[model samples]
Target: MDRDARLRKAVLWLKKKDPKLKRIIERVGPCTLTMMGRPYPVLLRAVISQQLSNKAAATMMDRVKEYYGNGKNFPDAKTLAGLSVVKLRKAGLSVAKSETLRRIANAYLDGSISDRKLSKLQDQEVLDLLCGIKGIGPWTAEMVLMFSLDRWDHFSLNDLILRKGIQRNYGIDENSKKEILEFTAGFSPYRTIVCWYLWRDHAAGI
Candidate 1:
């Protein structure tokens, strides 16, 4: 099925599977989960976003792009790979993040990672490949799968906000991984859409 049809089906399935999540769906309105952009740039921004507020991450990303390329366009892998870690730090990236960006850029530039290849891989394969990079952990890999590759099955248990959202909405303790998994098991294959609603609900303090 096409993306919209699949999302619609996913939403209906979710509404049937979980009443609480159905409430979230109703409160949050439509599932607007979407592929954000190309793998490289999306992954690049994900790396920049770690441990930072959304506003801070966006500001830093814009600064990095402006410093390395045109203010409006994200830099290519060659441009990123060519940048020194120190230069990237000057653009407001932390040292570790700068190093990570360089490693990611090098991974793309050297053909170790490719958007086209990633598009064809199974979810686990994609996660394994991406998480193999030194600084790319499971959470980041999961975000890339959901946002960049348009995969809908991923739900990052590592996301603290998501954990909080679950706790707030479902009254489950955030630290209970097993419980969380069991509670959300029915959301599989459409977990990304469920996640989008949870995020929206959390953002709206619902």
Candidate 2:
């Protein structure tokens, strides 16, 4: 299918999956499903952005951008591999995260990873490959799959806001992890967008 067709399908899927989400469309602006491109480093930057406020991530990314002199060309595996751990730590990355970056860079440099290979991988597979780096986990992997890959259907039931929203909506005081997982199954293929509205509603107190 063409881009327009795919986008139309995504819109229709999102609309049909949840009426609350349709209300979100009528109120707050469109969901910012911007693609920050496909590089691991780019997605890693986004992972760093997650949980923390956007302003904080921008500051850290600025440091990295300054180090590289330009954002147009992504610093490849070789470039990242050459960075000293101390320097990256000084740039506002946790020691573990810096190390994860190094491991991923090394994997890329050694030809164990390639863009071609990533295209064929599923979310769980990509998560498995990436989480080998230590700092990267399920949440971080989900963010990469959703944003950088432009995955139209993805969500993190493990995410606190979404979990809270689900519990609140269902009027449950608490639920086992298994119950939560079972509940979110209905949002499959659109769970990502469902989570978006969940967060938005929480923010708006609506």
Highest-TM-score candidate: 1
List TM-scores for all candidates, in order: 0.96, 0.82
Candidate 1 runs further than 4 Å off: none
Model 2, stretches more than 4 Å misplaced? Answer: 29-32, 69-74, 172-175, 202-206
What tens-digit string does per-residue lDDT give for candidate 1 at 1-206?
98788788888999999888888889988788878898888898899999899999999999987888789767888998899988998989988999999999899989989999999999999999999999999889988898999988777888988988989888999999889878777688787787788888888986
Please give the lDDT score at residue 59 for candidate 1. Answer: 96
Clashing pairs in 2: 154-192
Measured on C-alpha atoms, candidate 1 has an lDDT of 0.88
Q: Model-by-model lDDT, in order?
A: 0.88, 0.70
Candidate 2 residue lDDT tens string, 41-97: 555685567667778888877776667537644457788888888988876877776
Best by lDDT: 1
Residue 111, candidate 1: alpha-carbon lDDT: 95
Q: CA shift at 118, candidate 2, in angstroms?
A: 1.2
